[model samples]
Target chain A: MRVVVPFAAETPKTRLESVLTPAERSAFARAMLADVLRAVVEAGHEPTVVSTAPLDLAGLELPGEVAASASVTADDRPLTEAVNARLPGGDAETTTDEPAPVAVVMADLALATPDALERLLTSTADVAVAPGRGSGTNALVVRHPEFRVDYHGTSYLDHRETAREIGATLETVDSFRLATDVDEPADLVEVIVHGRESNRAPACLREFGFALDERDGRVDIVRNEDCAAE
Target chain B: MRVVVPFAAETPKTRLESVLTPAERSAFARAMLADVLRAVVEAGHEPTVVSTAPLDLAGLELPGEVAASASVTADDRPLTEAVNARLPGGDAETTTDEPAPVAVVMADLALATPDALERLLTSTADVAVAPGRGSGTNALVVRHPEFRVDYHGTSYLDHRETAREIGATLETVDSFRLATDVDEPADLVEVIVHGRESNRAPACLREFGFALDERDGRVDIVRNEDCAAE
Candidate 1:
């Protein structure tokens, strides 16, 4: 089955861009994108990044040869609407006479693993959603390409409902890594803690030298600049 | 008493600079410095920022007034050594008489407040360290300038003990705001949360509204990038 990774940049909510050096935001986005692409390739499927800020990729290079695409809407819409609008259009091109399944992943999953994707494909359910300790779903995969669903607020519950509406089996799996997405800085702590175990940790993370404590969660590591410059 | 804010860039055992955009690091430093200066000025004290980074304050303008000074160090020594080395040296013009008490604050304190600084000065103790929930010491004020002290490593407790050994009265105060410092991204959450109430808050944080629930300790608000961008 082909995998489609959907991603978008939310427009600035404030004038934070004016304060940040251009180098900082670019570095942040590049590092995050690298890990998502790596997860896709490690799963033995090609990945595509659909970004609103497509030009942000000019300087940095990503690993594993994943393709890049831009969202059609110049006017930013809700994440679910934009991502869902992109999926159905591509579904027909990838499907054969007997259509195969597709995995729709949120590109921000910091701890996504290849093994998890493999399991997602082989699972008995028509729809699978990975839920963390927090309420929202991080990822969802459908066994039937015809399974129509829009991932948005409370996606975990939405996916389960979508499975019932489509008369397809719903499955839940225990995946600590796949359940977490980088929505807030707090979410970043989890990745810094356990990212080494992931199949494709972006070079940025490795460069950051993320240190994990199995017990205490993510601890802050003093950076190289802290040592070399000051 | 004149406030001395010594900013140290601590080097961790691991380096994570590659993941962070240069802009992010610079923005983080600039933002912190702005807030710290604002806090100092609001408390009705002369603000001197003793930075390890090169101080070229030609273009940088802050609210109220701030003085920028650089510590002369050839290499990266321990954090304590670097800060102490920059203390107003005893030149011919510099009198031998005792200088007024100074509040040595961390540059990265997320919850730093003018009220906390005033409270710290009210006590007659030789030294006061603000301790948070965990082992982290957020801010420290020394009323007695004659006593020599150094802060480095996880040995904040040992630093306090050494202060006592030198016949200096050491005290610890519980401060919710002064206890949080931003060394990692996760720490940024607290700044974004509690900073809403601070007079030193940046234009960005004020633009992005925050609902701080003191009971549950959750900040509910729509995240915005405009503040940072501006």
Candidate 2:
């Protein structure tokens, strides 16, 4: 099946801004989007990235087809509506005749690893939703494009409910790398707490004059006691 | 070589009075000490406990050999002094005359697990220090009894230095479950963070009234959050 990556293209939305600083938000979005595009391209498939924003993401080194949204500011619409409008969808549950499946991902997840994404896309389950520990969906894969996402109060929970409404089977898997998203300052703290020592984002935060006092595998907002010399 | 467990027989100094109410301190201390003993027993190595404080911990449900300390507080002295003072130290370092390697562990590691402890003891290294992430020594195994342990400031670092001084090779391994000791309130958070789901001290803390705002697999002492509500 044709792989579809429907992402809202705006300069940067406030919902995204509320979670990460401007630099972090831009880096997070661009990096994750590039990562997903790389994974799809490496699998010998062309990914159709449907974005509602301008084509300003040109400079990013992505290895897939880029499609800009026909709308002005695509950030205000709900997540599923934005995605379904781009892929082949109708009033009824959107189903596709493609032999394989389409993988849908939100562009804001910094925790999605290539291995985990590959596993998620290659999974044979009828329906899959990558639910964040908090109340949100990070990614989803459906064998048929006929499935419509219910992106309402708590999109993660709503997507699962939508699967049930459509008589689709759902399964939860333990994926430490893919189960997190950078949403709020605390979420960034969570990322850094579990982040790899070589990860660039946390180091970028540190280099950008943000002090993160980390100890015992927990990250606290920069505090004076931790800032003296280290 | 014989395995030696050094414990302070006197109840842990009441450092909790500043943070915990009298009732809370009493309960916390009792639970902490009890778990320490239980963990040592659960780890399957019945220790020859050399108590620095004048009290009896041998009655707990574990195989143990107890000896009372000649001093009130054994501070800053090399642990080698404390341990060797109990065992026959003369010619103890010789591989031919002395027994095999001995494991020296503090009795205050309340979160130690039998599986992890077995892993440490079964390791073939001449000397091994189970490394906790931050600066602290939880447990170590020395093949030579004559190998002196000057556990000085930040003994985790000092332990490595002492190992080098004794001409012993040092190995670092990650099994925090077997190496965490309850020394400070922050250390107690480590116990609560990685302690087994069935551990009683943290459970008792929650039962009495201590809130652990767990985030990203670590516990934080946040007050307004409900512990038992989960």
Candidate 3:
């Protein structure tokens, strides 16, 4: 299977601005992309990173196949547009040369593992989706040629309706790791709390001196006192 | 909101028999129950554990209200039938004194956090469901007077159609914490990998000398040789 990870490198994760600076956010975004790419390759699939800007993947340890191949495509278009154009039945897609199956995964799924990615990529459903915490499509596999994603409001629901309209079967992949995308400041807490042993997203953030303070029944992301402020 | 957690204490988690003895499975189930109960109480709600048999919660440290109140109800019946009998629209339920809103949560949600429970219980939607990994309803809140549960095959889909049939609003609490339920040996890896720092399910399993050997990209639950076999 071929997977396309849509990453917004420029001004990415704006919701995390309160906890992470612009530079930190960009670096964190790259780290998350690395995690997603590794998971895709480890799940036995080829991945191409569709970024809003040219990604500086320096110092980030990614899968060799992804880094060496022309896997990272820089497109400054919106997430939905860039992703749809790469789909099998989208604009300029030739019927004879179209890819039979393709998957679109968000770059911010910090908790995703190879097992979770395997479930999504190998699902026999016409449209397999891993929905976000809200009405967002975090990761999805498109076997049906007519099913294209829309990143607008309530996109998860829209994807279901669109699949139905196109007479495609929709299977919801209820995976915790794939469903939880790190988009907000509070989401950082989730990654720290539930991240796997070797998950690099949290390791990268921790290297940036990030910590979560859970006290008095409230959770907050804080900087480590030992590490001096930048 | 009043929340009911359906627990099968007699022969719990039969799918895990290959990995755990019956006694260990029951103890692990109770540990998971304790986690869910604490999450519900900390989320600021009342919970009652509806068990198939009287639970032996001797070693498990549960929430004060859950441990103190006459909250544990023993009903030896099928899970679907037992739960439907408690709903407001079920038989012998008073139309005048019906609890306007009620929530049903599975006791095996080892990853459920207080924040996840708060999202399900505090939803203004007429019906809120936290679907499990498959077509199972892991947790749900019911506000519609005519709505009832059916734990048959594809219960999650059944609940959605039931809500629509009764002219009630349905909202999916797309929560990862509430979705991952500890069931099989393979699921043990999930608990150990993604379990919170204070989550007791993995801790309880660890106490049983359970360990995951993730060698050569394959995850296997094993016993620590240092610890004597049970």
Candidate 4:
């Protein structure tokens, strides 16, 4: 199976702007993307980074083993369109004698592990979905060529409906790593606290001097001024 | 309107047993209960504690102002039944020439504030619900006599159906404080981090030496053994 990691490279993690500068946000976004790509590549998939713009793969510093085989494609369309276009029958390059399955993994899943991705890829169902916090479709493994994605409001529910309409056996994968995507300020706390064992994201957070601190009765990310000033 | 705080005093916060002893859990549960009660009383309502067993009011150490008017009652029924029985028409004592409205508040909302409770109490709808994280009905205000509660799975959804069935106007009160209920071991992080501005819960968590720490690539609550050892 081929894995597609859709990344909004141009204006990624807009919600984190309150804490991170635009450059910092981009760096953090790339770090999370690299972590996700590492997991997908470790799961024995030829992962493709579907970017909104041309990504500087050299600057990303992905693992050498995975980086060697990884590919990048520029797709300015909306996420659903980009993902649908990348699926087997939609793209000329992906069409084969027998259609291979495709998995659309989100770029912000900093906690995703190789085991989690392998479980999703190996599922027998025509459609396998991992639901994120709230109503998001975090990751999807689509075996059916006609099953297009809708990343609109409550898209997980919509995916289930879409799967049923196309007569695809839908499998739901409830994974803690997949469910927790770094979105809001509160989510960054999750990354700082839960990502110690991870390579890329935790190192990025530490480099930025991001630490969890309580302020005004809320768990917030605080940066050491001296370290950040450097 | 009368406010009922239904506390599962018998086996309260069984989920916290991984981190807290049974006595510690009970103390923590009572601390959260006091916080909710304090908010209810500050909202200018007579609050009652509906316990699974007869509560020792003197031992609870509630705020003096709230404790003066607060009452306690024993009811071993399920949460739905206990809350429904406390509503206007369900209880004979609560039935009057002009029925007063009822608000059922959960005891585990460590972040609840007086202003939050006041907003819920003053809502014009016949049934006002405050939805918690996941599928919980955090708090509910019932102005219509026929409006009862069902604290089953996805209870906020069930409450909406219950309101519709009874021909009551349903209002959803979206309060962050009301939504954050301390349940799992992870939830204690929320309480320790966000309850700083609050009174009882924060103090209790601190007294118990609860602090957020990272271990094994997961965010977890760690207690200072020296402080807890005391």
**Which candidate order results from sorting by lDDT in descending order?**
4, 3, 2, 1
Query: On residues B4-69, what C-alpha lDDT tens digit does candidate 1 reach at each position?
Result: 566543332112143234544554556676677677666776666565554544334564255432
lDDT by residue for model 3 (A1-230), tens: 87888878778888887777788887788878787787787777877888788876545666567566427769988888898987878763546764678889998988788888887887899999987744468899998877888887557767989999999999877667788788777678767655666777788778878776645424466787565335
Which tens-of-lDDT digit does each residue in A104-223 have in candidate 4? 999999878787777678899999988764446889898887888888655776798999998999987645467668877677765764453756887888888877665543345678
The DockQ of each candidate is 0.01, 0.05, 0.07, 0.02
Worst 10 residues of 1 chain A by lDDT: A12-21
Fraction of true contacts kept, per model? 0.00, 0.00, 0.13, 0.00
For model 1, what is the alpha-carbon lDDT of residue A17? Answer: 45
Query: Residue A228 in candidate 3 has what lDDT?
Result: 31
Best candidate per DockQ, number? Answer: 3
Q: Any runs in candidate 4 off by more than 4 Å, and if so which?
A: A196-198, A214-219, B1-230
- TM-score of each candidate? 0.42, 0.47, 0.54, 0.53
User: What DockQ does model 2 achieve?
Assistant: 0.05
Instruction: List RMSD in Å for every model shown.
Output: 18.4, 10.3, 20.2, 19.2
lDDT of 2 by residue, A140-210 (tens): 77765456665543555566677778787765433434555554555555344434454455554555445
Full-model lDDT, candidate 3: 0.77
lDDT (10s digit) by residue, model 4, range B1-230? 68888889889898887878888889899988888888888878888899999898888787789899799999988888888887878863445667778888889988787777887889989989877644368888888888877676556666888888879999876455677778888777657644636588778888888876655423457788876632
User: What does the lDDT read for residue B163 in candidate 4?
Assistant: 87
CA lDDT of each prediction against the hidden true structure: 0.53, 0.54, 0.77, 0.79
